[model samples]
Target: MKRILLINPWIEDVSAYDYWLKPLGLLYISSALKTLGVEPVLVDCLDRYDSDLLSYSSGSGEKYFGTGKFVETVVPKPDCIASIPRRFKRFGFPEEVFRSKLQQLDHVDGVFVTSMMTYWHYGVSDTIRVVRQELPSIPIVLGGVYATLLPEHAKRNAGADLVCPGTGMKPIEKALLFLGINKSVQPDWFDELSPDYSAYESPHYAVVITSLGCPFRCVYCASSYLWRHFLRRDPTKTAEHIEYLVKSSNLSDIVFFDDAILVGGGFKTLMKEIEHRSIRTRFHLPNGVHARFVDRETADLMYANNFKTIKIGLETSDRALQTSTGGKVFLNDIYRAVDNLSKAGFTYKEISAYIMLNLPGQSEEDVLDSLRICEELGLSPTLNEFTPIPGTLQWKELIERGSFAEDIDPLLLDNSIIPHWWKQGFSLDTVQRLKEAAWSLRRKLSGE
Candidate 1:
């Protein structure tokens, strides 16, 4: 049997949190290679339970349903963002620890590296470098969002033997074939194979990708650029996975990582199956759901099925901006969704509206108005800062206006630096005041 190694690269960013985050794509690939009779060794740099890492942990302690911060080491800022006033850090295992882990592997035929945010490519590049230093002759393949969105940049910067773009398990199979190990079996959909979460230490919560690719292409989003087409997994199969998880362990929560979970009627069917199975796991839709899809039936089903957290994408209240920015949602859609959710016995505090800020031409008042609309509708507000992604419409506009450099380092793309670093149309004071107002409203609603 061919031996294959898979790695989850560390994240080099100002800050990062583990909100039930897991590399589902990489796990799925692991499942595929194992089924093809390849011996797979999985190494996650961000593994929280690593005995060596835990010894060095600062005793931050996990909080709130197994979701908390990742222990990070402060590193020097990259030259491109040297002027920015925030400390850069690597949010995973230390260099020596990672190298020691690599040294333990033997005669690996191929290595697969996974990436996350575009700005966090520094981690991916560093991981590839260390892998090359440790295993010089093995072929390395890089894949994930950063590779898919900015393939040319990754090719030029990320020192990998090959870079595979987009979704699916074909890249892993292809890499195995390169090593002269071929599986002459009938092809099946990538989503059909269950992700191998058993590879990790027991996890308290799991992430489920019931669907992929959103139909609406928001100007600031890279969903369309990354996924080939919209796809949804079989509802019964998804329920079976959830049931297996609950039965195998004390799994109490699940976070839906779908870009759009309710695009089709699949959510309703999945809920029905879960209800039939009597599985009592709490569900969270951290990725914003489409407001237009929330009807009386779906809303009630979600409430009945124990969806504790629901966040809706209400980008802006400006009608023209709404129409221009992909027309995904509007003021009326927000009102209707909120009404339906309230009727389903969900409290206002349970449902939050994501109001986007810091667009190229977006003003402070525009964002403030959206917050006001959400407040009027008795919904809590979450301020989502706009980060210019490589292939998006807003990215091109920022580049044309000379506000962003043609060869800008991806580190500057962090969303938290919006008001602090970039002054597109709003001043620092305006941004500060608007943020304060939003938080103030949230506190008042929660009676904190």
Candidate 2:
């Protein structure tokens, strides 16, 4: 059988955490490759449960709910951000471990690398560079959010023989064709294929998306740009996949990675299916759900289904800011949603509110007011620093407004680093203060 080696590259950033992060797209591609009769081998650098990695880290244990820090090694900051004072680090398995894994593989047909944030392209390029050194003759393909968002940049810098942009099986098919394999994937692959979690030896958590894309066009979000239309899987099929994961793997957590999981009421149906199947597992919704859709029934369903972590997208409590940013939610929506969740037996610890900071034209008071509202509603506050995505409406608007040059380095767009460079928004000290405020509020809510 023809073999393709799949790699999830290291994350070179100031900081990163494995908040139930999984290469779901790559796993799906692995399944697709299998269906096409191609053998797919995986080398996931971020797999915290990787036995080799565990041994390398001296058997460090994971934190609560299988979410914990990646093994980090401090690295020099890129020249563009050298002025920034924070220490830049590569967060994942050591380079030696990755190289050792590559050396063990025998005669792979090609290599496929997946990327995450657009700013993390440095990691992608470095990963491909190493792959080239190891297997000089083998072709390498790059695909994922970074490549899709900035294809030309990836082609120029990522060092891949072929860069497949966009989503779904089409990108995987493109990669296969580049390898001279002419095979078409099934049309219903989205629903038919499950992420090949068998790639991991023993994952603590498995992330599953019941839907693709978002229905709302939030200014700062790229979900609408990434996927033009919204689509959902059969809830029964989704439940079946969950049951399979529970039965086949030693998984303690199931995370939903959908951008808008609660839009069409399919989540409720899926909850009922899980209940019907009697599959007991700790579920989490780290992705911010639309508060407008969080009715009493939905809250009850989430509670009955044992959702351990629920995050509601309450971007800002300011009325104008709420309407300007796609109007997907409002202050009243947040109020009602919290009430429903609290009535459904979810306490402040189980529920959290996503309060965005550093939004264009937003004031410090706006963020403080949002935090105050979270406190009043008895919900933990999570401060999400706003990073203007490349193709989103917000990015374009900022460029047009002359916030920064159109061709600014994507790495400077990192939220932690943006405050240092993006002068139109918050200063580095102000951002620090805002983070401290959020932390204080969280402590207060937790009764610390």
True-structure RMSD, every candidate = 2.0, 1.1
TM-score list, all predictions: 0.94, 0.98
Model 2 C-alpha RMSD vs. true structure (Å) is: 1.1
Stretches of candidate 2 exceeding 4 Å from the true structure? none
lDDT of all predictions:
0.82, 0.90
Candidate 2 per-residue C-alpha lDDT over 96-181 given as tens digits, one digit per residue, 9 for 90 to 100: 98888888898999999999999998888888888999999999999999999999889988999999999988888888989999
TM-score of 1: 0.94
lDDT for each residue of candidate 1 in 1-448, tens digit (9 for 90 to 100)? 7888999999988788887778888888777777778878888887765666677676434776667777788988888778878888887788888898889878888998988888999989988999999999999999888888888889999999888877676665565666677763225654478778787666677887888788788888888877768888898999999899878867878888899998977999999998999988888898889999999899999988898889999878888888898999877778899999999999865799888877766777888898888778888898977788898887887788787786777877786644555545567777778889999989888889
For model 2, the run of ten residues with the poorest summed lDDT:
416-425
